[model samples]
Target: MSKLENIRIEGIFIKEEGRKATLKFDMPFYADSQPVKWADSGYNSISLEIDIFDIHYLEIKT
Candidate 1:
């Protein structure tokens, strides 16, 4: 088995009204970005809400 700390964000899901609705993406966030709210300590996936404008700017982490 792998260690808890070895686990990392592998995907992200965002739900927003009047927009794309449900979006599931494989990601790590970004090298220069900050970590957002996670679903667990050994977080490998996340669910959040995002605006239409910001959707194009999203990037995966290192």
Candidate 2:
């Protein structure tokens, strides 16, 4: 499994007709189960897009 630590939400979009949603993250990093070593870590400048499907309940908090 992968882990995303200290990630910031950049954007969110929902499609009612398609019953899908997307979450965008900034400053994301790819890491495994091992302990994260910041000294050797590298930052990803690209944004991460996570596509989620299926309908249920949705909640948003700021």
Candidate 3:
């Protein structure tokens, strides 16, 4: 796997409400300007509520 593929996001699915869902992760998050790149800066464990509409697609791995 490439470096990007090796970047795993370990999180618990909180819930889905309307067109939004929340995730609670223990991993640090970085605000990347590019869609496929991790930025240099990052924040500690965080919970994020993201709009489903903003997502172009979803990928789930079993």
Q: Which candidate has the top score in TM-score? A: 2
Q: lDDT tens string, model 3, 1-62?
A: 52333334455352343334444333244444433322333433334433344444456675
Candidate models: Cα lDDT each: 0.42, 0.73, 0.41
Off by over 4 Å in 2: 1-5, 16-18, 28-46
Off by over 4 Å in 3: 1-18, 28-57
TM-scores of all models? 0.19, 0.55, 0.26
RMSD of each: 11.4, 6.2, 8.3
- lDDT of candidate 1 over 1-62, digit per residue (tens): 84323334434455453333343343344324335553334465433433343354455465
**CA lDDT, candidate 2, residue 55:** 59
Q: Pick the candidate with the highest lDDT.
A: 2
Measure candidate 1: CA RMSD: 11.4
Q: Per-residue lDDT tens digits of candidate 2, residues 1-62?
A: 96767888898999877589999997555444434453346643557799899958788766
